[model samples]
Target chain A: MENKYHFACQLIREAGQFIKGRMTSDLDIEEKSGFGDLVTNMDRETQDFLIAGIKARYPDDAILAEENGVTHDIKDGRVWVLDPIDGTVNFIVLQDDFCIMMAYLEDGVGQFGLIYQVMADKLYSGGGQFAVVCNKEPLPVYQERQLAQSLFACNSRMYAQNTGGVRQLLDQCLGIRMYGGAGISMSKVLSGQLLGYFSRIQVWDYMAAKIMGEGLGYCLLTLDGQEPDFKTRQQVMFIPKAKLTEVLSYLKGVTI
Target chain B: MENKYHFACQLIREAGQFIKGRMTSDLDIEEKSGFGDLVTNMDRETQDFLIAGIKARYPDDAILAEENGVTHDIKDGRVWVLDPIDGTVNFIVLQDDFCIMMAYLEDGVGQFGLIYQVMADKLYSGGGQFAVVCNKEPLPVYQERQLAQSLFACNSRMYAQNTGGVRQLLDQCLGIRMYGGAGISMSKVLSGQLLGYFSRIQVWDYMAAKIMGEGLGYCLLTLDGQEPDFKTRQQVMFIPKAKLTEVLSYLKGVTI
Candidate 1:
């Protein structure tokens, strides 16, 4: 077992259990600019926990987070992009299906990442030549399944607009699903439960999953068929090799 | 507590646990018709389990099921509609988020229903003047939320065709979500986690949920502005009273 993967499983398991315990108490929730965008005490506490742990073990590490801003320079030794609670709104409202996510980068390249579905107690970790695994079960490399043979997970932003491309893709897929969070949806694709995922998300949302998915030999492209620049929040699609072309054709001319 | 509600929780919980145990084994998967139409041994085994239990306990009562078809006349004294595995594709593929659903009708009147999310071990049950409870926590009466304030869950069939009303509503709402199963999506609304649900679903899918939502003061209406005719699988929207008018206005011309 790689030290990073071992450390991730233990750290995320503790964070998930701790956050779930806090959910039973009265939650202190506040909106982050948007009305539906939620952040809570648990989110901050969990974020701080991860940051403190990384800083203690790797003092030179860089940290970029959703709740709190960046800690160190990406040009520095190791950088970790973390979304302590990816589905903060889901966390505040449903208390289930939300996630704790992290991506560890070596210098500049994506190396290790974890997307943990807390309520379900399933942690997906991989990258840097490591095979992805859910719990302890090693996930085989994702095989290319046709676009018509699988379900697609998407964010609400796509539906709120009902883009023609999105509508076309939804029509062609076997079915559709949304968990209101990038972590669970991405995990769906990573574990082969879903064929692909389309969403407009931030670096903190997709970086970890992207790293792991790339390690599995999948295509991580923007809806416009460009590699994700990771500079600004952009529309991204993590798809299996077989479905990439078909999904991209549908996504053309749409500002995903 | 009504005998039916008590019975449903006990029956469905047992079924859920039994089916989950079987999921670890090698599943016998066969196609019902198309690729997305899945039927696993667990689905059949669980459905038969529920049917046999019903026959043993209430031999005279009618039963309607997804796999085995109607066991008795709809005009019989009491009819129980059951979908042993609500999300069969999810069950066979992802092995998570599938549900066990049942609705009991007495002389053609919706009386009590159970929509149990098996993987999550949370059951939503109500009707017969009982408050809905998930596990031991009683779900509060669903307060009306605006269409602009919360999310809506819908089926891809509506989006595939881009029914003018459906697209307009999706574009206008806070966001849109799809759980791919009516039982799970409706559970989201019943628990106040989602604002509404729109889907073209079968009797086995919506009967129990419709009964519980109606009991909680939700508006259950077809897009064509008529009462849901159980005889036909029709497009139905179960929404809060606050969002009903706006949603209905969008559905005026569409044949749901």
Candidate 2:
């Protein structure tokens, strides 16, 4: 593995363990924009710890994190995107779906990705050139499953509002699951428990998963079939390539 | 507590802990009747455990459960309605929203209820003369929050249908939360986390929560404003009394 990629994995594992250790303790959880949006003091503290360690070891690398925003220069052609605690709500509620995620971009291309499911102690990580690994074992790109045999992760409101798309997708799939946490939903896809997932998500939500999905030979694309821009928020869908054509074709027919 | 009610609580607590212990372990998950329906070995096993224990202790009691159908004879004086694993999908996926739910009906009237959030280790139980309790502490009916300031739990598909009184109810709430599990969603209402919850649900799904909500000074009513039948399925809404009046007025104006 590349040295920087290895370093990123090690940092993510450490951060994940740190969060897990505090999962059941009293957390300083505060409402953010709304009841649905929450932030914990632990989130900020973890971000600070990771950022400081990364900056000290790699002074020239660019960093983008949930807290402290972006720092360092981008001209170095390598950037680290981090979400210290991806499912803050789950963490606050003492639920176990929360995760720590990291993605490394080199020369404007996603080179490596890591997602650590804290409570389950499962780490999914890979570089584009290397096979995806789960708990140190290689995880192959999932084989194609028919929509009637596959499970899709989705959010309730979005799925309901876009009924035409959802119905079509549901008709083709074995079932639709709404688990309430984006990181864990995507992790299900990565772990082969889910065949695909579609959602209107923020950039931070997609960063790590997109890289991991692509590295594992799954197709991660914008719903509109455009190249996904890492810097801007977008609606994205990740599916195995064989299922992609069918899903996109079905979605195209929907009014939304 | 009545002797029967006390026994019910003990059984629910034990079953809840049993389910929690198995949350992350391998489960024999399988589809039940259709796409949206799922069944697990744990679901059947839990149901059997509850049914056998109930029968052994109260030999003459009529029993109803998700897996075993109905058993014994309805003596018109006492009946036990049970959903051993209320959110099978949540349980199958190891999501934390699943619960062990039970309701007792005396002369076809709900007399006792229990909804145990196994992962959180919180049990919401009550009915008839007893006040609702969370972890054994009585919870007062929330009287301060208005509809505009409270969260509401709802089924996503029902929200999309915009029918059966949900359209009017949706306009009166601060926001809607779709957690995908009826037992888990109603537990939130009993705990004051949600001001109310309305969905097209079966009797098995609402019996336990309905009993608990009523004991907590919340209103559990049908959309059409009729008494729920323990022997039949119905669409129900469980809401705090103050909000119920506001929601009823809103629904009347919609003319549905």
Candidate 3:
């Protein structure tokens, strides 16, 4: 397990360096679903590199990568969920604010997670066996803040749709931030910079950060305050346990 | 004029260093208007330091600082506008994503502008007499991008309110970013990373970036597609000239 974790970290670091180097070159960009849903040549390249590294080390691991869909049932064996470039738009436009994220799960239960902010070069990693860490430093203890005292993040889709009382939640929090990358935004919540993050995201988007955050005494739940189903794309509120009730009260009559 | 611009730059750098040094210590935070609107002791201290330096060097110039507000009207002889600490919420919570901004004007005409991103140590400065620069390097030329290819920013208030067809504008753009600091967000636009930024902000908030951006061939206008009044807090769009018509078309039937 330790070897797998270290290998994942090293692979992510190399991928980060690769992305940084390619930023100066023209990115071959394509719209995956529609406008704003972007995929770059680098995303595919990075995913392949990471998957190949994992295959070389742990040949039996089931992989669920962003660029490529799942090959095996995630609940049956060791699975690695990967988002090669979490903020593809940001990566294309600003050449920063993106991250490489991966999570290791055994029998569908999360065991380890890693989120590497590419430009900042900060790697946040942790699991049930060990405490969360950012680079060489252990992350600070999780300090739960009231909704009004906390800065929060939500996806623009949610904010635009006013989904699940997101606007009310915005008014309740200290302020709002939208970084366009789940890894970057969720990492901020994991590091205690943001009180909570609410977004309807995919398995690869939230899996690593969810594990890393839960290790820090945080909880990720649906807008209805239930455990989020890991198998489907869904809305999840990643927040401290103490603030759940208050946050849910505002999210009671969700618009979407 | 050159001496005054250099002096402002020097003073802002000192303030940045001071703020960075004091970040690890207690901030002595106070909410000025309500929950999200914050003002720290450092804001007052930084403002005083900047105002004092301006008075010592250019005593006859009228000064308008965020904390102290306006004393003499800004339309008079050479006026200095200062937001000692922009993005106070970010400064308090994240210890980053904030800047020190100032603009020099003569009889209501912008002369020079400076925005110092404290933590990043990035000082963006320029105006009519010079090209925009970040530290030692001149900024890249601004390119005209279609609304579909551009990332845009708007204040959370406008977003939540869906003001000026804000929600429609969100759908048309590539993505949305809310950094909670006009200086930080606008600087991104000034550097051509973002297509434009929309906000209902005050003079100190947009004045410096407006000058710096205009120097780069960008224009700042009201949501109704007119020049923003310098005397009042209002909805303003800071974007390039080629994008003006298309952006205003989406914002035609603004809710607010």
Candidate of highest lDDT:
3
Docking class of 2: incorrect
Stretches of candidate 1 off by over 4 Å are A1-8, A24-45, A71-76, A159-170, A242-256, B1-5, B24-42, B71-76, B160-164, B241-243, B246-256
CA RMSD of all predictions: 3.3, 4.8, 1.7
The superposed Cα distance between candidate 1 and the true structure at residue B22, in angstroms, equals 3.8
- Score chain A of each prediction against the true chain A by TM-score and list the results: 0.93, 0.91, 0.96
Candidate 3 segments whose C-alpha is farther than 4 A from its true place: A253-255, B253-255
What's the interface RMS deviation of candidate 3? 1.0
DockQ: which candidate is best? 3
**Candidate 2 per-residue C-alpha lDDT over B153-189 given as tens digits, one digit per residue, 9 for 90 to 100:** 7765567677676766666554566665888888877
True-vs-predicted CA distance for residue A149, candidate 2, Å: 4.6
Instruction: Sort all candidates by lDDT, best to worst.
Output: 3, 1, 2
Reference-based lDDT, residue B248, model 2: 74
Q: Candidate 1, after superposition: displacement of residue A159 in Å?
A: 5.3
Candidate 1 global CA lDDT score: 0.79
